[model samples]
Target: MEPRLTNPAGLLPDVGQAVNILYKSAHTAGVPGSVLELVHLRASQINGCGPCVDHGARAMRKAGETDDRLFAVAVWRETPYFTEPERAALALAEYATRLADRPDAVPDAIWDEAAKHFSEKELAAIVLWIATTNFFNRLNVTTRQQAPANY
Candidate 1:
């Protein structure tokens, strides 16, 4: 479908400010670029947000991520292609973003596993990464923002 509005430029205020916050959050948490991309892609896959999935997947590849890892991300639990840290991040992503389906909160096992590969700051960043990606997924899906033709 075509866009509901050409830009919706007047709809929101401080759009630049919001983007700045997300950009700072991404860097401050020291979440690796590759890790952040994977988290975004995985969350977007679950949310079925085409823009996020396309953007994240393209970013991952641009950052030199292997096709095997990208392709297997959705089925990561059943594959041996991911490294220990990536696996932990994926698990944490699922647990955090799927909170509606898991009221008990992220389990200790998942945290422990992730903690093994991340510092406290890194873990905090990871959580923020997941949260931020979720926000973008919702925004894109609700707005029906189409993925870019080349994305």
Candidate 2:
């Protein structure tokens, strides 16, 4: 689909810069880059944001994630590719991203599991990553943004 307009980040440089700052901070929030990309891809899949799924998967590959493991991110519970910590982060990402679908938003069980694997700072980063991805997902989906062919 043709996008309604150019990417807002390009159209509005100041707002784009602010988002870039948040994006950069999330990357340094101590979560592994691979785990963060997995979280990003899953959330984009849930949100049906094609651009994000494309970009996130490419980013994961660039970080040396195997295709087998990246492809299995959606079915993480049934896969043996992820470590406990990665699984915990994915669980948290799904729960947080689907907040409107469930009464609890993030159930205590999921939070407890993630807490087991991540320090408070890391947890904050994970949450921020999820939130940031969701923000971009909405923007892209709403604007009918398409993934670049090379992305």
Candidate 3:
């Protein structure tokens, strides 16, 4: 679908910069770049934001992630490709993204699993990453942002 208009980031430079700053903070929060990409890709897939999914995959690949693991992110539970920590992060991403589907968004069990793997600071970073990706996903989906042809 065609975008409804030019990307809002271009139209509102200040807002775009603010988002960029927030995104940068997440990157420095000590979470691994690879994990963050997985979280971003899973959330984008669930939100059906093609641009994000494309960008996330490319970013993951650039960080040295393999195609098989990236392809199996959607079926993480069925695959033996991920470590326990990765599984926790993916579960957190799914639960957080599907908040409206349940009353207790991000149930304790999921949080507990994640806690077992990530330190408190890393957990906070993961939460922020999930929230940030969701924000971008909603914006892209609403604007009908399409992935570049080369993506």
Candidate 4:
């Protein structure tokens, strides 16, 4: 599909830069980049943001991720490709991205599981990553941004 408009971040470069800064800082808390990638891909998938999902998966693959893991990401719960920490992060991404689907957006059990897998700092970073992904997902979906032809 053609985009409804240029990416808002592109039209407003400062907004893009601000998001880039947030993304960079989100990596400072020691959560593995792999886990962050999973979070991004899962959230984008949930939001039906084809552009973000395409870009995220391409980035992961370019970084040497295996097809097995990438293919199983959408069905991570039934797959053995991800580690426990990765699973926890994916779960958090799902619950957080679907906040409107439930009254208790992020239930304590999910947060506690993520906490058990990640330190406070790591959890902060993970949440930041999730929030950032959601922001981009909304932007892309709202604009009808198209995925790359090759994706």
- What ranges in model 4 sit over 4 Å off? none
Model 3 lDDT, full chain set: 0.90
Compared with the true structure, model 2 gives a TM-score of 0.95
Give one digit per residue, the lDDT tens place, for model 1 in 1-151.
7655533323677765786787687667876777777787898999988878888888888888889998999999999888889899999999888987865889999999999998998888888878988887777777777888862
Name the candidate that leads on TM-score: 4
Clashes of each: 0, 0, 0, 0
TM-score of each prediction: 0.88, 0.95, 0.95, 0.96
Give each prediction's root-mean-square deviation over alpha carbons. Answer: 2.1, 1.2, 1.1, 1.1
Model 3: per-residue Cα lDDT over 1-151, one tens digit each: 7999777777887978888887888888888888888899999999999989999888888888999998999999999999999999999999999999999998999999999999898898889999999998898889998999983
- Model 1 is weakest, by summed lDDT over 10 consecutive residues, at 2-11
**Pairs that clash in candidate 2:** none
The C-alpha local distance difference test score for the whole of candidate 4 amounts to: 0.93
Tens digit per residue, CA lDDT, model 2, 1-151: 7999987767886977888888888888888888788899999999999999988888888888999998898899998999999999999999999999888899999999999999998899899999999999998999899998772
